[model samples]
Target chain A: MAVLLLADVNDGALATDAVAKALSAVKGLGEVHILVAGTSAAAAAEAAKLDGAAKVLHADDAAYDHGMAEATAALIVSLAGGYSHIAAAATAFSKNVLPRAAALLDVMVISDVTAVVDADTFERPIYAGNAIQTVKSSDAKKVLTVRTASFNAAATSGSAAVEKVSATADASLSKWVEDKVAASDRPELTSAGIVVSGGRGVGSQSDFALIEKLADKLGAAVGASRAAVDSGYAPNDWQVGQTGKVVAPTLYVAVGISGAIQHLAGMKDSKVIVAINKDEEAPIFQVADYGLVADLFNAVPEMIEKL
Target chain B: MKVLVPVKRVIDYNVKVRVKADGSGVDLANVKMSMNPFDEIAVEEAIRLKEKGIATEVVVVSIGVKQAQETLRTALAMGADRAILIEATADVHTDIEPLAVAKLLAGVVKEEAPGLVLCGKQAIDNDMNATGQMLSALLGWSQATFASELAIEGDTAKVTREVDGGLQTIAVKMPAIVTVDLRLNEPRYASLPNIMKAKAKPLAAKTPADYGVDVAPRLSVVKTVEPAGRKAGVKVGSIDELIAKLKDEAGVI
Candidate 1:
């Protein structure tokens, strides 16, 4: 009974934390075989040697060039017979692709599994991580997506064999289009060890750069509240809340962010939370392990200097 | 073009869900229910397309118990032309998987033959984010998920998707599936006259079995537990104190 883990990759390299973390979660299942399905998967295949994986199956084709869910699902469904279980990181790609694969197999998918209770049972969060539920799959084949933030990334020390595979068939229903990604030098928000987030209190888009400077010094990712994103002070991807990306990094620094319940839903799981706001009554202070009642403008620069 | 939108009845977002003491599931007795917020967005988008003369008709569908008829009426009041209630018995053990739901919707799609299908990316309750993608797979239709903006031409639909980092723009031919994001548009409230008129609108009811799909869940809940809560913290007197706690105690820095 081998397990197949779908590696999330971008620009030819694999997601450093998501694949390994998903690999770590499924380590006890059996010999983990990885699937790198993409157009240019050579670099990702070379870097997919996480310690938990025994083999990396590489499937490269133009049909998968767009990362369309339909084609990817078809490719996985064709290979599903060899593995007892299939899994991937609960990222955008997995969210799009895994369900189609699961549906093709005529089974329910155990989404965003935080822990492996056994080969067929798993733990996942419901109601936006407010409640955890232990669910058992009755299907013959179990398909899963792992929450990247809940587990630690496995070490990249294994010498896994990389075997190139062919695309099963033509399942192209969508076409590739342009991707307008935000150019950022800082770490990606979801996998970053430390995240410094700003909110409406940051005032303007230009002033929001103050949070970036502090994050740069700490090598942290820059995040934004929904208010900041709605106000056009930051990109939509920067927003962290129930409606946005949920992150559980090691250290989360909230700068000028008043913690709404929705916002707290996303980052409350952080190991160490630090809130910086002039309003002592800010909701963020309630969850912060260390709360400082100070103006972000004056405090942030001082903290940058201290670092 | 005709637009078909699939909606869901979920616990009102304002109501705080409480886990059952016996580890069964979230208690919903006497709780207020409303249309899923994302589904409302989808309905709103479809209505806007109709108002703009781009869509000739808009049909709404919901799958749940008899109470879900109220949700379909709500969608009709919100400007859907017609409604279809695909019934499924509401019980702890009777829940529809995304695949089953998709298959049921595929039945509706085959009968309706709509040129465009607009649905929410995911219901807030389950947050599976699978129906639209799964349905598209079943129908062999082009799909655009997390659509923040959409504009339809004669045969092509241009969509702007809210991706992880930023946005991506894509073009798909007609008869495509679009799963709306929150940024698409704010759903308008049904006025008194419209609500009254919705009472008289034609609402047809059917069952999942009628569509040849079984709604029994493929996964069973073994247990449920409230997430660990974070305790109230203290205010740091100085930056030095904050740094000390982060480095010495938290060891995150």
Candidate 2:
């Protein structure tokens, strides 16, 4: 029951949270090996060795620079013969690529898994976290993408052998172009302990700044509902909903956000939820542990001043 | 170029799905059903392509129960030229599998030979998100998933997809599959006249048997249960009171 984890890297560094969580996922199954596919795998390789993993496999190739699903899926499919379970952090990258590998292997992918009950049994959220489903895979090989927020990070120290694997061909299905990611010094919305989110009721981008100020005061991350992101009040990455990142922070505050079912799907698991809105029936108040009905413009400033 | 859009009938996005007490599955009995939100975006994109003259014809295909015909008609009302409904039964192993859906779609793709295949990123029901990718691999065609923008040129389709990091643009060869992200396009409302006209559009019915693909449950659901819920807490009178509660009672601060 060997496991292969597709490592998520950023700016030449390996994303450790997902890998560590994934390491904990396949804990009792067997030895875990991580795949680092990128242009410069040096930093990621060095970091993977300390992931408490059995081995680190690096495929240094320019074709994988953008993580175009076609090439990355092919690379994993070719290497799929050795591993009993193939897993990745359920990020945009893994969500885009793991299914491709599963298709090539003629198996169905188990997505956003929260717990590994056994070698073949897994627990995952369905119907937007309102329901929990446990599945048993009859397929010989299990292709899975795990929700990183649900698991603890594996310890950071260990010595594992590093192996250089050959790169696969470019699928040429698509080419990478320019990017416009949000650049902020604030904590990342998904992993932040405290998340402060805004919605369309924020009025405009200028109003969204108040949400950010309160987040800064609380040392929290800024999140936005789908409407806020679509209304251009926040960056696309700031969206927290069914289509966006699923976060289970310690504290979640909704400012001017009338919770849509999709938006609630992403953050309902938070330890504590507080809603501040003028609309008492905004649906967000239904799940909020503490509800404050007031205009955000008035409420946010007061909260910021208090913090 | 002819376009192929595959749509799915899923639990309406607005509906609050309830897990059955018996643990069979999510209670779908008498629940409102609608087009998967992402698939609606795909349908809208294909219609836009047709309206722009980049595509000459748009064919909408769905694989599900007989009720799925309504989903196809909605696509046709939006502007698809025709529809195909692959008949499915209620049984999991004997009737529908995600792979079976892809295989049947491959048959349609072979027969229609559309230059572009558009579909949703995933269905809300199982959330497997693999059908389009599986179809692309089965056809040996290149693919672009989570596409937010699309532009068609000679023998190439340049697509911009939404990723966690940011938007990424890629060019896949013609005759490829593209899965739509939520932001791809806002679907238009079907006018009363268009809804009537969609009823007259050509709709063909087939089955997984026609595609010669095996239909069996690749994975089994062992148990289904309601997720743990947080109890409703007291409402705070003031901002200061909320802060005190957070620090003292909740201890999250």
How do the residues B52-143 of candidate 1 rate in per-residue lDDT, one tens digit apiece?
A: 99999999998877788899999999999999999888662245678888999999999999999998988877767888888887888878
lDDT tens readout by residue for model 1, A1-307: 9998887766566776888899999989988989887766564555456887888888877667556777788889988898889999888778878887887888777888889989999998877776789999889999999987888889987778888887865654566578888888889999998999999999999999899999999999988898888888988888897778889988999998998866887899898899999999998998998999999888988899898
Report the lDDT tens digits of candidate 2 across residue range B1-253.
8999999888888788888777877888787889988889999999899889899999999887888899999999988999999877663212255676887889999999999999899887777677888888778788889888899888998898888767777888888999998888889999999999999999999887887766667778888998887676767888999999999999998
Which candidate comes out best when scored by DockQ?
A: 2
Candidate 1 docks with a DockQ of 0.68
The residue pairs that clash in candidate 1, if any, are none
Best candidate per TM-score, number? 2
lDDT of 2 by residue, A181-284 (tens): 66778887777899999999999998899999999999999999999999989878788977888888999999999989889889988889999989988888
